[model samples]
Target: MLNGKVVAITGGFGQLGVAVVQGALAAGAKVAALDRAPAPAAASNLGDALALGGLDLAEPDVAARALDEVARKFGGLDALVNIAGTFRWEELEQGSVDTWDLLYRVNLRSAVSTSRAALPHLTRRGGGSIVNIGAGAAAARAAAGMGAYTASKAGVAKLTEALAAEVKDRGITVNAILPSTIDTPANRADMPKADFSRWVAPKSIADTILFLLSDSARDITGALIPVSGRV
Candidate 1:
């Protein structure tokens, strides 16, 4: 259903980010993958699609140029998925206030930068979709050491809701997917003894993003859909 469409993903080289890129390819869309650091060799699977590295998406001008590059390459952009973010396990009790600022830039500012940049291209296409990666932790009562991460993601949820309303008449749909403990290699390494089976799979999250970007979900804007699986 995504044939001929162009979709861009930020944080597009990470565990879940790669999954979303592969998912978009499977749906026949052209994908642009951007990251704050260079993608590993594994990302060669993207095979000539747009891939940018070391971009500070926290900077609005850089973010805008990235999207402009996509449009220049693809003629137009159809979807944008804000997946660039960071996770810090720090608590108010002993964690440094510096973590709060770092999380704000990596999580909240990244989304704000990308979404603002993509808005014009999406609008130029006559209509499109924007998906933000929100944490389930942001919705529930945050865990003890999750304040920084949760607060930033809460900002993402609010961005999705407010942007959806702002673009209601412009045919753009903004939504966020909230996932609980995505089962990445990094997460597994950190929680070696945890029940991996209960965590959401990257593919599942990618599938949810596909649904939101597809025509089937045209009416599903301003929603924060959770993809916890059995978690």
Candidate 2:
């Protein structure tokens, strides 16, 4: 369904990002993987995917540069998936200003910067899609020490809604996906005793992202879809 399209994914080297990059490529879309980390050892599995170094999302200029580079390399840009983010598990008392700033920079500011940078590209293409990854914890009350993380995600959700309204008439769609607890390798290693089966899989999330980026989702905008696997 994504044939001939070019998709840009931030944090494209991480677990979920890997799934998205591979998935997009398999679906016949030109994939641009953007991440602060370098590309992993190339495997025969990735066909024609391209990896690009991305800057800290909080840096406005970096966002613009990344988008420009994508447009130049791919001839045009079709979709942007803001999968870059930071997570911290700290109590309210233990949370320092630096921690709050760092998380906000990665989780919230990155999406804002990326969306703004990709807007003109999407407009020029006549229409496109932006998918922001969010956390479900933002919908519930604080969990004693997740105040800052929760607040950052709340900002993401609100930003998605506001941006959707701003770009709806321009043929662009903005939406956020709230996943409860993703079953990533890091999460599995961190919580060995947890039920891995209950956690949402990275490929599953990527599937949803692919759907939203496809032409079939042209009418779906401003929606905060939940990808929590029965949690």
Candidate 3:
């Protein structure tokens, strides 16, 4: 579906990120997987996808450099997937303000900085798609311990809307996928007794993201689509 497309995905070393990278590659796109974590030791599964690690995407200079490298390697950029984020369960009363700051930096700021960096390249391609990973919790009311995480994710949702409008005339589209508790290994271990069947799968989210990036959804932008799997 993405043949000849050059796509870059942030947080590409994690479970969901890995799924998206593989899916994009299968769709015949030149993929670049950027992450703050170290590159995986056995990345043969990533095929010819470029794996760039130790990037702090919240920093504008860092994000710009990373994306510049991707554009240099791929010849151009056509899509971006912002999946770098973190979650913390803590009540405001018990949590340090630092938690909120950390979430903001990692979740919202990272997306903003990376998207800003990618704009020139995407514009040079005449158009491109940007997909962000938001949270279903943020779309709805926050639970007792979800204030910080939800707040950060809500910022991401708002960024999608605002940036989409700002770049629509430039032929760039921006959207976000709001997912419920994803059924990853870490989530399973955290909620061992929970019904794993109800949680969304990483591949499910990846498929939705791929659709958003393709020409099939070229007219869709600024949409905060919910991809909750019965959650």
Candidate that would win on lDDT = 3
Clashes of each: 0, 0, 0
lDDT of 1 by residue, 97-177 (tens): 999999999998989999999989988889999999999889999889999999999999999999999997899999999
Error of 1 at 162 (Å): 0.5
| Tens-digit lDDT track of model 3 for 161-199 | 999999999899999999999999899999999999999
Q: Candidate 3: lDDT of 62?
A: 97
Q: Write the residue-wise lDDT of candidate 2 on 62-110 in tens digits.
A: 8889889989999999999999998999876656878888889899999
Against the hidden reference, what TM-scores do the models get? 0.97, 0.96, 0.98
> CA lDDT, every prediction?
0.92, 0.89, 0.95
How close to the true structure is residue 58 of candidate 2, measured as C-alpha lDDT? Answer: 69
Assess the local accuracy of residue 107 in candidate 3 as a C-alpha lDDT between 0 and 100. Answer: 97
Best by TM-score: 3
State each model's C-alpha RMSD to the native. Answer: 1.2, 1.3, 0.8
Q: List clashing residue pairs in candidate 2.
A: none
